[model samples]
Target: MKKKVSLGFKLPAGMKPPEAFELVSSEGADDPAAYLAHLEDSQVEGIVTGMGRRFDVSLISKLPARIKIIATASVGFDHIDVKAAAARGIAVTNTPDVLTDATADMTMLLILNVSRRMREYLELMKEGWGKSLGFEGMLGFDPAGKYLGIVGMGRIGQAVAARARAFGINIAYHNRHRLPPEKEGDAHYFSSLEEMLPHCKILSLNAPATAETKELLNKRTIALLPKGAIVVNVARGDLINEEDLIEALANGHLGGAGLDVFKNEPHFNRRLAEFPNVFLTPHAASATVETRTGIAKRAFENVARVLSGEAPRDLVQAP
Candidate 1:
């Protein structure tokens, strides 16, 4: 007999829940409160969720004792309280590697958007490019032959470097450990972010969110970049200090910025919307149909693995 699991939300198209699982429903799949309420009277052995809900200690304590595993359908698992889950003997898993290329592609798009001032240009076109545009007006920097400093050299960061190399951009990365020559290619490695910032004409944040990484980019750090430097972040919104970034963009210390994630998502900093130099996306870096479906499949596979008395491949570590 196959064990049963519950999906906290609907799976993306082309992906299906495990045949052995029994799906359960709540008033709202994305609501943590609703999920807890539903679990109170449910008999499911496992629950599949996403980044939308908070799986903190409070909520984890309310989960049914029969629930043995939780699978989140995203690469980042900062939203989940892994330590609490582990203490409760509940396994937690995340979908990674699947969204690496998709996120890296979005990073490149942000780089281009900020460096070329694409948002401002598009707005002009939408309002009608009637006025004669002067050559000196709305000039933006070219990324070719410029320095790009990556904060993290993980899978997605490395992927971004590979794409940037084709555009003649010089790559320098700061990571906890340096990569070997083969994996690093022609890229330079820096052990310290402070040492790398001055040389970076363009800076990209790709590090995961943690106590050490949260708000890593702030006023003092932003001041280290070369004047008029461009910034892009496809990583978690908490990685950068929103206030500091806004000040830099407004003061022209930063040439421009492209951000896909915000500290307060869905209700992102409204001040950023007023800046023509700042381009923002509503946290949809991995929204492509193919990538989303892949994520769903991976999350489901994790649930299936644990239910089958096997260890999940993408299990998350306790903090």
Candidate 2:
């Protein structure tokens, strides 16, 4: 008998399924129903997938009894219900650390795009080069000595703050607990978003998406930020109110925004996409080949560890 693994992978929007799986994927295949029939197959033991909301929390309970591990190929695992998997004695793992640097780099890129109006400036280029009437062509602010408010002080946030330090940006953060001054060093800590927002020129929302964090940047919270302040989000899409953000930028309440992720992905917010002050991406914060390969390797390694009856090195739950 041949050993087979059943994986519930969410295919990339236009990508043909990878050659990694043996059971064959429904993506681009003639019969999509063939993939769903795995529930009745007895040989399938493992599952793997992309980052998405499809496999809802309740679905984990209905998984085949033979399924022992669920691995997600993303640095963020907020989509998976960790506690549910923990209760079933099924381990959950996520790809992390590998994307820390790439994501941090995107943060800097956003900062430049939002502060300096990169998209609008490019329009000037297309209209014909060197046609300047005044000294003020496309004014994007410099990062030096500006105050940056980081919502989540995790690994990626820390990496962004580190780079900001080199550019002489004054860094502050709002976290559940404060890191010691020696560890935080030059970066200051604010107990609340209110206290932090007023002083920041660039406010970054880097927290994972959750029930409490959804639509966190609504009108009320946006009002707390200083006038003409830039904003950035490379985290989960649900963290901000897209409609509210657009209005802010259009009304001149905010300077601009840079986003790598959005609330409704693939089907992006048409309004935000049209705004010249808004720089948008299709969630490529960790899109580098080296980073993606590492993510895949970590996800695979975690599954192998669970199958071997040894705890995964990056286990999010106990066995």
Candidate 3:
């Protein structure tokens, strides 16, 4: 008999499951009932999934006894309850590092796009450039020499700092703990997010979604930034309060914003699209072909490790 694993997301082209295990196909999140049924198979020992579905306690409790591990393709594991999986003696892992550069690149893309008013200019070009602007007609700020305060100084945050430095942007970061000098480089460190905000002309959120970080950028925090500041988020969406952000944009408190994620994904407030100063993507920060393929490979490797009675490489919670 062959070991079996279920895939909750479509694998990239030319990608195949490890020969050691048999592949089980299901509708995944598209058809929950069918996906759950597939999980109930006695031979299925592991699962590779994506962020499209939530694996809360209610769902984790229903997992079959044979399921030993749950591997998520994306770096973030907020979609799954690690504690709940741990309670059931199941291991949970995530794909990290593979998508860092891709996500960091997207962060810079959003920063530059928002700073240069690319959304409005792109629209004008698409609509056929009907009017010529004077020197100051649609002016945008230059990122060069501007202060960019990052909320998190992890892998993605450090990558963003490296990219931003090439553009002559000064980097400042607020993390739970300061990085070593070598890793910190010349960037200023702020232990308190509130203390760092007033000096940042450009704010980038690269933190994870946790109890302490959820809604981290509410109205009060947003107010701390200097007026006309540009905001960007390539990390979790719940880090910001959309309603408060919208109010700031409407009141001319913020110059612009670039967002790749939202509190309510695939169903964000339509008003965000209404602002010409706001640029949005459907959480495609790590959507590059290379990154996506790498992430999928990592996910499968994690499952293989756990199924083979070995510890996973990026284990979040192991039981």
TM-score, one value per model: 0.96, 0.88, 0.96
The per-prediction tally of clashing pairs is 0, 1, 0
Q: For candidate 2, write residues 1-319 as lDDT tens digits.
A: 3334555454434444334444433243223234345544535666666765455556777776787877888877776788887888778888878888999999999998788788988877898867674787667789888999999888888899998898889999987778877668889899887888989999888887767778888899999998999899999889998889988989988998999998777677888878788888889988876777677667777777777778887777532
What alpha-carbon RMSD in Å does predicted model 1 have with respect to the real structure? 1.5
Q: State which candidate has the highest lDDT.
A: 3
**Model 3 per-residue lDDT at 224:** 97
List model 3 lDDT by residue over 1-319, tens digit each.
7788887766777766568777776554365555677787535899888888888898899888889999998989999999999999999999989999999999999999999999999998999988898778888889999999999999999999999999999999999999999999999999999999999999999999998999999999999999999899999999999999999999999999999999888789999999999999999999987898999888888888998899999999532
By TM-score, rank the candidates, best first: 3, 1, 2
Among these predicted structures, which one has the highest TM-score?
3
Output candidate 3 Cα RMSD: 1.6
Worst 10 residues of 1 by lDDT: 25-34
The reply for model 1, stretches above 4 Å from the true place, is 1-3, 27-33
Over 1-319, each residue of candidate 1 has an lDDT whose tens digit, in order, gives 5566666666667766557677675436456666766776666788777677778899898888888898988989888899999999999999999999999999999999888989999999999999977878998889999999999999999999999998899999999999989999899999999999999999999999989999999999999999999889999999999999999988889988889999877789999989888889999899998998898789888888888899999999996
lDDT of 2: 0.78
Model 3 per-residue lDDT at 185:
91
Q: Candidate 3, 61: how far from true, in Å?
A: 0.6
Model 1 lDDT vs. the true structure?
A: 0.88
Clashing pairs in 3: none
